[model samples]
Target: MSNVSSRVSLSDWGLEPAVDYIERVQRSDGLVPWYPDGPADPWDHVESAMGLSVAGRDEAARRAYDWIADVQHDDGGLWATYGETDGDEGAHAGDEPRKETHRSAYVAVGVWHHYQCTGDRAFLEALWPTVRDALAFACARQAPTGEVHWAVGADGAVYEDALIAGCASIYKSLAAGAAIADVLGYGDARDRWLETRADLGEAIRSRPDRFDRTWESKSRYAMDWFYPVLCGVLTGEPARQRLEAGFDRYLEAGLGCRCVADEPWVTVAESCELVISLAAVGEAERAREIYEWLFQWTDDEGVFWTGYQFEDEEFWPGDRPTWTGGAAVLAADALSGLSPAGELFTERLYD
Candidate 1:
């Protein structure tokens, strides 16, 4: 057990209210939209569910995971975005449908995180097929160079361009998927996921040319800078160096992390995820400090505002996303060791 929890009181940090906000945003069918009225995306949906699991709201978390099972397409993927209702002029309505491989595969991480928090082997077993199919769906789209294609279009054509942050996330998902397979005694599945993950990781760490091939470079985004570390694709001293190398470019002192290198806007979710990444590389003290800087943006109701534009000196977009709150909860857990999976980002779970 780590004494990291001694450094900060999770309750004092507003963990309860953060969890409450996530639960409140959750719809009856367990959909966790970006906000009360915003559309739901698969990756953020899973991130919020992970927060529910960390807060000991296991049943609520289960419902969120169940939402994935309910909405998953037969191809083992969900559309890139989905509105709360089908006919409204909401965020995702009337948009061309595409399935992001990273989003589709993220269920593995959520399911494994849920199992770590609860130690429910039966639950893990129940979700195993979903995990298996989702990983397969992702792997099926991988190019020979090992970067998974970012998406499949509505016409079922593969989007050839890959994203650095997205591929980093897929690496983590494949790790979780492999862990699940190992626990269930599926040796062959475990081996396959491990093999795929290794190849994907090599592409991420060594072959920058593979990503951003079709679009303008996304290197300006903070996620592209740190997600490789956050998702455990980069670890040890190299992970620490990767974060340090880009620290000044992304961090805004006493505010939060910037969404992009050129922007003065600092997003709560990005800061929280950065906190976890810092902790992942044995920088817990700095991680704690960064995590503390975030509470100033929490509203009277305890949900975090989407982001702040320091240049305009206002909360931009005026939306408090459920996934933002979820990221905060997960960051706190990573620092304070509040749940069995508290070290989820700090340490590797599978082998």
Candidate 2:
């Protein structure tokens, strides 16, 4: 409603170093490792790419998408995890050996984001097949009750339960995919994706029990708490109330949002995402307030740390994740309305 300013040029929101970190970790194939020798997850890789777009590195973003397309499996799935640059860039194993459904779907959001930033119709046209295939990989596993499953393995088996965080992200991917279809003149296909999006949103709001319930409950994770709002499946009064109910659960007044509700840790990324989520629900003042607090977590040189250990009053993980910087850039963009991709986190793309 307000379309307010977020005080950009004053700080660049530490994007310079964040961009540096993203570039440092990015392999020649455009695959950005979470850290050097780290397992590159698809969604985190895309977030880093989106950060590049926010910083006017459009070509980097496109190449990031290209790397995504290059490694995608024929079944429309990307590995839930990828090896380090020195190792096989396409090999899909990590600290664990399972695959995730959301990893494949996130490419849609990246493709649409690149299009929004560059207005590159040719780029969108080229990636349409990947978008179509990835969404199908995710959507085919949606339960009749409306929730999509969390991940699939290389063996081509489905994990029946859904993750609220993953599903919330997939919801955005679905909306973005439908929007992509609309741009490419796939009218019938777009309608189908729109229908699927609505059904999935209904499940997210009306059926939280449908997700990640059978396993250890993941409600402690802050992403599951705010993702629906951040992703636009929950908005307006519903979104505002959802955050209000959970404020005490994850928010730390002077630190940041917690990775887990009960943990006294504050992640720069989650804090940044909550800022966008607040703005999405018309809580712009609160959004800005949290955004201001986030700078406390950055380094002397500007790159943000992974998270702070508030209880110990120290840095917890001892790593400056590139995606953490990406989150800060995106949050600033959302608060300032600085770029086309700013609203990528704040506003709903589909009605």
TM-score of each: 0.96, 0.94
The lDDT values for all models are 0.88, 0.83
Over the stretch 1-351, how does candidate 2's per-residue lDDT look in tens digits?
Answer: 325653453255556887877887888889888877677788999999988887778878888999988988888988776774334544443433445778889999988987887899999999999999999988898899999988775466777899998988989999999999999999988898888888899999899779777799999999988998999988788888999999988988888799998888999999989988998888888888888887888788788889999879898799888888888878878877556667777768876
Q: Give the clashing pairs for model 2.
A: 101-151
lDDT of 1 at 19: 83
Instruction: Give the worst 10-residue stretch by lDDT in candidate 2.
Output: 89-98
Indicate the residue-level lDDT of 289 in model 1.
Answer: 93
Q: How many residue pairs clash in each candidate?
A: 0, 1
